[model samples]
Target: MYLDINGEQFRILKAESQGAWLVSCDAPGPPRFVDQRELDAYPRAPAPEPCTAEQGEAPQTAAEQARMALIQPLLDNGDCVSDPAIRRQLAAEAAQEHGTTSRRVLRLYYQYIATGAVMKHKPRKRRPPEYENYYKRAIQTFYYSAKRPSLRDTYDLMLHQFFTAPDGHLADKRPTWPAFRHYFYDQAYHRRSERTIARDGLTNYQRTARPLTGSAMTWKDHIGAYQMDATTADIYLVSRLDRTKVVGRPYVYLAVDTATQLIAGLYVGYEAGEEAVMACLANAAMDKVEYCRGYGIDIDAADWPSKGLPSEVITDQGRDFLGGRMKELCLRYGVTCEALPPFRPDRKGLVEKMFDLMQGRYKPILRGRGVIEADAQERWAVDYRAQASLDLTQFTQILIHCILYLNGRRVLDSLQMSPEMLEQGVAPTAAGLWQYYAAAGKSALLELNPQEVYYMSLPRKT
Candidate 1:
């Protein structure tokens, strides 16, 4: 018997029955149970039969051979991993090897199919499930989740949200960070890297930051301070609110020594004004020498260093930076006050970079967690404004703390040295065993000259 299914015909009839309709697709079926009164009264559908393959119903003899030829490697090398190209080639080679002639591997693979001929395959070790899907999710989260997550962060996020646990387990078997990163984090590396060419925004203040010099900043022709500036750093808004409703108050100001690349001064530059810078300079002196925030080992308190002054103070020519009072103060102190032209912070590039590290790098991290609490915000403001009221006499003492602890303790990447490195000299390991021994003064290791240990390159264009 034959019946049509979706435009294809299948041989099917009643194969077996317990009642009413007798059925058999392949053979005679038992009689169906029926009421004697109306045994043949109702309409009946034919029972399904054991269908035999029509012309195109099954793969041709050649197709069976071809498929087997294609998949014979698992038979030979039980654990071999298959590449698509290699897999295809494997099939062709297997067909040749097995003597399956002139047919697709699928068509001729099973000509003499028998047991133990095909070996099974297993999933790859460290292979990701659905890599494209993970890529889309991880990349989207990385870009949207503020400042882009670090590679580790992106991986962690996926583990937390996407990966699932199977039932009957005591706890979910979370994949290790390495495994998660093998898929998502590494994929990001393939993308083009973001270019971060820094432009200097500082103005040239080589003319006369030195109130005491009273002449050309340098008698040497064209010899001037090479001021570099950078800006728009992320700064934590130290205030009473949970987070700022709008631009908040109390930002830390950090001015760095370009030549040395050490943070010269750091103060909670409240909003923006002369008071901010003066306060920062005070911090510089405090963090450098007079105070005891010794060299190395990562402790977190600020100290005051005695050496507070810089040869030049390069900054943007903002009103607060270049006002009469700031210029006058610079002249009095004999510090060259150089200002960059409007909008070009590159002139003061060193300090500008400090801003980037502070704002761009650190602030986003802190902000994401919402670190500033009410009491800290209050303390930050009170201390900042209070520093403003002190006269120059008192101001000097305040700056002492800021300079030694905060400014002098800063580490620099250029020389892999600390602010204390100049005064203390390089580690024995870095400058070499003897030099390290000399700087450390290990009795056997004689100490070096304070100035000579650090060779400053005069900023003179060589």
Candidate 2:
């Protein structure tokens, strides 16, 4: 039961035939006995709803238990604990024993008595601003954009727009700059993704802020799902017919098998369009032994065994991959073509990563022999074009060597091997995994005529 005595509120702690004990509900104190006649003089208030042990309560920590134990004696003293001198002596004794201050001990005792639990003494949550929506609208209008203004500038603009009087003077009752800054950061913390996209553009957000939880292998079940993309090689090349003639950097197309992390096929050429893509597809469908032999390199079929058209090809939404020729080729070959969403290169990360590995392997040895340095674009930098020495054929041969090494010998530490493969002692190299899967009849390779695929992939004028 509760009572309203004058303006103070008290809760009934105990009721006896002679009198009743009441405690102040608003503050911590021991209960005081009041005569029945005096209690009847106060107005009764409706009882507050009962709070269960589990209601809005968290388990107490070790520190809270220790603190509560230290103050147990003071709380047991009843009304004597409210006396300043007596309470001070009790707090000092507990503080001396527990290595805490007397003030803290007294505060904790009062808190526990008022709330009935140490966990209920948490700091109160701050109230939001009354004009929260106005601040949010101002931030959205003047701050979260490609032309991002500073918070100070944003606040100034907001004041000019929303807090200006009709006479063009600033209103006296306006939010402070610190308040606006606090609210701005609070909103930004919660709307991180939305703020990044709005201020830095979607491409930048996808590249930097987006979470990388999914792997490229998630979309592939076998070796036939290939990720295809093109990148400009960092090295410059000369014309095949004349080594003295300096040609520009060539575009290199790569096809990577998602399941085995294998470089299925590659092409180095002057074009970055449908021609280069079709040529790469032709190379993938043909036997690698003959292709390496054309460059005067002899390799066993087992060394570079990846061949045949893939069941599905994943690529970015580039003009080369979205052209009519690409669609016609997929339709004729019964291949499913998947174009990734714009600015989402992580979808085809296998082929994108292959470009880096392929270029990094040869760049060190080929420096000053046509390889462009990182600062080539700076003023007074070396003329990388004049240093070009390797012709198209020589560059192609170097790339083939790198590809052979990657396919046959590179150890894949992150490869996930099945129990059967592990028991069979299958190596973790690309070729080892491919050969094992092929022998187990788990490969998705389609046996098509090499000459037919080559001729059909050739770009013809409409």
Candidate 3:
């Protein structure tokens, strides 16, 4: 007999004298004990034809046992019987000799030989939920259509709604507490219920739910795709023109290669508008050999060969990123500017994660008024602006140093190697990847007039 509990099917392994049936289910873990009354709800299947295997035969593999069971009777008695009573007697004797239940022995000897295949049980059709249509609608509206509410509170509210029905009648029936809990907390509405909370709802779904079934777009080469993003620096800075005058937090824009987690270009300044993005792109496109020399850092042109426009640039839906000017600039450079959906940082996670790593590295070192604590104002009780000593030039030098170290030394968890190592396959630094890609005939980098692309990327007054 099959045991059907809440649309699940289980096979009866043995019947206990205490009115309980030991059943085995397909679900993970061990067998369970089910009451006899619950077991009686399911219908019994028809018995299979009897097998002629010897009663004292040793246990064997499914195929071996099946072969023995099928031809043993012909070998012993020259014929098989069609009598059910005789089959039951044979099954009982076989069970005792094999030290197993009679039902299992009969099932294997009859079903396994007849089918000639392994059988896996299929679940039965599920019955409808206890709640009516209107109640379901109400639950959906409260739980999914709005901020997440406590399951207990939802249950209490549902009970109240039932008692205060418009027709002045209470709900006819209520489900058991276990049943209600299972439906809401352990089934379809299980862990997904937390996604309805209002705190950064779109970001929460993008970060948690979307990633489970989503994939990152792949690129054929190193410079094939570049991800750009902007974030406010946690630490405060002072003006480069005047060291005594303190500037507010600056916006840092970064462009990272998608194939390798290499930072191609970066810009740090007071404004986070389209102009900053333009500056960042220009930095990425133009040779940084001269730019680095200006800071007394001597570098050959081959040391940082990451210059040249990428085939595609992906950025989030910021005002600067979504503007038509960005697309026009990409058109001029033979590139594509793709804006990701609003509030989705995962699409541009390469750049966003870099910003987080930068913050973690820099914030602790430059502790003063620049600390990112909520009670920073109260705890320090000092003017952060006055305490800020790192001028823009000094900060820029420090940032460049950090980037160089990251490109050369930092190992990545995802790749099990540094970005530089993965990019070059042999290079010890990101510059090696740059040189190798530049040498390859299939480079996706485009030659462009920086002055022209910069002008086009700037928003025009309509």
Candidate 4:
């Protein structure tokens, strides 16, 4: 005996004292026994009338005909259509015959079953948004401001400000909140940088919203171009003379080779300006073996191979880089000085990124030893200055190790290896790349006299 339960057809196989053994006629599964009491409790409904397709309203397009053909077998067998297992098997066979997925075949079957029209299988066209001009003007004027107003608040303000009658009464045909929100998000998505600059300010936009297109590898033909930049180390340092006195954070200057991504030079000190730049350049010109030895770090010359003067130095328009002393030194050494325009740190992104990479390596290990936490500026934050345990020399030693690790051991997955280098199975490390290129005589390193470089790098006493 067949009965419809909750819109699904089921067949009773046998009646027992306590329950009746039943199997679903609309879905495929093993026979299930239902309690006699529960069976009586279900409301009985006449089976739904079979969905029939309109006679003259046949499929018009090839896609519609194809969809109808895919679902025709399931429609022909009404009993199997109700049994999920049988239905799935039929759909899978149809899918394989038609070169389509079973899921797509099943979806077509359900679509035809519901509407009895193959045309319903086609996707509907998307309509363009009909946002009024006043709505967009209002969003631009009020929504994209430093005040950072919400979409709802902006809509409310627009209704009162623009969508009002001449006599100050609310207009009957104002834009809805839902429409305003949709339009705002649409505009924000399309004009992300503009929205960010207007709402969060230009600095925030430059830092987070600016589009990154080109890479520093654009200058990867040679190792002569060095990008120079300065940043204050996050950790506070104590004075070497007096361990009790907190000497504040040290200024770190790094000169990075664009082609090989090597740390060509570095300077960590309390001084800022031309003096620091000169000192860093002097270090870049001299051999690093003796410099490491001075810091009690014994290493092979090949370990820290980056040395000699760069052909061109790229820096931001800082007063130090723009000073006469810098110009004089660069002119004397025939080094091209390219100071980037204001608010354009993205031009020297390699050196800028290196600062973060170098600091991130050591900051985790030196946490309580004076590394400043992100929340150090917040109210009731820890006194990071008092936590200073590392002096200048100690911090320098740590920085040297970090630089050595980055140059010699750290793998740069983004580093583009030449065909020759790849053929030789060269490691994608800064030192590895530098050594490979230098050995090939493609190095742009100028072997300047150490004494002349040192004397020229010293601040001129007029």
Candidate 5:
């Protein structure tokens, strides 16, 4: 019987019990199921002789006939596992691979077991061809285009071209925003350039295309190596001597142990000079019990025993570190002042990454008062220096608290353990690790004349 569907005539091969007809369209393709109600309005062709199944004239070969015989019994056994629980597990795996329900698999197994016949059916294609085509063409176009807008922008462009009429109105067939996003993002958005998507997207490309990973700097024991660098803190501060005076953002110099990620020592300074670097090194090499007491923190000497000269300190080739007096001081203490090549911060990634993490942690606490970018401060009408509440001494205490927290609690991402954990086999805090190492003679500490090391490190008149 013939009926009209979607403005085309189709032949109804059979009618299902559920009021759907197995119909074949005029297009050269497999037959499809059509609802009976849709074709009810169309006139049907005259009733013809009932269709009958035709018997095969050609006999199947022994090999071909034997194939189904083997398959039927194998499928009857349901994945060949005799145990009931194991059989179900196997059936579930097969069902997932075949994109069907486990219950459907069990039903097929039971049918084969009873009738000795295996059911073969075509699997439905869940993915739409339009989505595939649109994503492929859109990604290729955007990736090769000079003006690589963001992935979101490229999706918008895809929508505009595929779902908009020439008259600037929505077309009849259009994908929803969520569907469009899923389709586009699944097409590997990282292939685009930062010029198109910006910094966050550029990072993906860096991760994929750039060979940034290098050999890790490791040590045999604590204090075997250390990293020292200086950066201007994000928060502006009042002077230690005078609270009314607005000292610009202080340059923070930090010395950190590479093996344990412990903050050995630090110096927060207002002026840009060699004195801060010298002070930082002195702080790192000398005992910190008196230092903490000076700041009114009351830290026990055992809690922060990471003192004495390290075998080496890794730093950049800055003038403060490259001075003749600096070299003399390092040699005097039998410590190597290894200067990394220019721009190779990756050699000291531990300290660099710590700097970033530290800044992020402080951002929330110092909101509306901390070191915002100059442009952001102006745009947001934020007077960071004027709003600053922490004096140099108070800021130092806060920094100490931050360092202690990191050593004690912050899990190191690469190691999947805290610095304190590696420092002491089971130390719960960085200080605990330090104390354990100090008592066990595992700390690579070299006793030095602090007074001599300090004076030698002092910048001499050029």
Candidate 6:
């Protein structure tokens, strides 16, 4: 009978009794037990009891001895399952061999496996928490300060802010880092454990800020289609990677449009210079050029006028934004470029959101690769090491997969519409798109700068 050797209730496939020997002719492949509690991933079923040696009873037969030997290895090796339901079945099998009560043998066997001969699990006491808040706002005063905060940096700040004693001296000192490291650095011993996951009780994972706006988009956005900007944060390499073996230093770039905030182009490349920027733009434009055409958007295959280019090109005034070939290219195409103020990221909010996405989903991919450099030197270092060094270029292939997944995957914010869905349905041809822009009064807004890559922010605030 198909039996789950761990539970109280079990199936009996075949049974026969001889004196005290209830032999199971159908206990397939030496009895097995999987505790559903420990092995939640495996399928669970009811089980029967096993045979056992009784008090003042005769010895077992040769077949019973053979079965015991086969099962002994499994039990000793930590196999036969941990699921309680299945354990009962195993007990039933043992009982069948020895003609004893399954429940009794199971209880004794379980106790032996649980601790061998030690104490069982005991509950711990709790105490009231000291400080409530952890994270300080990103400034000391009203003005926007230039601050670079990392995971460790934030942790240190939170620790000090919370543990600062009122005495200021050494009277009744606070607990040390060793005492509290478990919450942040502890590994889960079991699934579904109610473990605290923040860094020293600081709620760093969740955003506690006000909300801002825009975009009519969806996940239906085709792989080669949508555009995005940097309302994003994780513009860096994967954070949790083994930096000793592999390292990364990437520049952030984002592509977005006014309506649905779909990331048309996303990349983690060497430099955030003009070349990277151009590559990103070109890559995005290339995708747009491909996916848009299939849906009938008027992307000029041969010639693109600046006014008819993108409805709007948004960015902040970084060194990468306002120089050399970048400005020249934009001017030549008549694309209206809008740059955010020096200290105001809110002006170009989408890219900020993009950075947030990066820190969460994409940073762990590059852990352990130290020395986050920006050139081929980094690749060479990995090659020279050759042992722990993984071929990053090869590793980067999954990034392309992730991009495709993000593009094709239905974006929930799309209100049930996909990016591909929007692009496919919007059938404006190139000339028509141009005409629409011109008719929309962008001619007055187009600042023809042959050399300037960025457009100044809001009339310079007088």
Q: Residue 233 lDDT in model 6?
A: 24
Against the unseen true structure, what C-alpha lDDT does each candidate score? 0.40, 0.80, 0.62, 0.79, 0.64, 0.40
Tell me the lDDT of model 2 at 262: 87
Q: Is candidate 1 or candidate 2 better by TM-score?
A: 2
For 1-462, candidate 3 gives per-residue lDDT tens digits of 444556554555446655443333334122355666766766554322221332345545676665455434422431112334665666677667657666765555444333322233357645355464434554565655455676666666677665457776665666444555656654566455343444237567666565354224244355557899988776678777887788877788888887656677878777677778887887787777777777777766655567777788888878877666676676666788888887778778778888887777777787874555455559557556667767766777777777776666676444434465465575645555545556665467777766655675455687
lDDT tens readout by residue for model 5, 291-384: 7888888776655667777778888988876776667666666778889877667668778867877777776787776566546535567676
Candidate 2: Cα lDDT at 324:
76
Task: Order the numbered candidates by lDDT, best leading.
Answer: 2, 4, 5, 3, 1, 6
Q: How do the residues 285-387 of candidate 1 rate in per-residue lDDT, one tens digit apiece?
A: 4434423333222323322212334446667767756665557555655667777566545445555555544443333334433233335455434332222
Which candidate leads the pack in TM-score? 4
TM-score, one value per model:
0.32, 0.63, 0.58, 0.72, 0.56, 0.34
Predicted candidate 2 versus true structure: per-residue lDDT over 195-229, tens digit per residue: 78888898988887898776666566678888999
The candidate scoring highest on lDDT is 2
lDDT of 3 at 458: 59
User: Residue 13 of candidate 4: its Cα lDDT?
Assistant: 50
Pick by TM-score: 1 or 4, better one? 4
Ranking by TM-score: 4, 2, 3, 5, 6, 1
TM-score (C-alpha) between model 5 and the true structure: 0.56
Candidate 2 regions exceeding 4 Å error are 1-137, 161-191, 201-208, 271-273, 296-302, 317-319, 322-328, 341-343, 408-421, 457-462
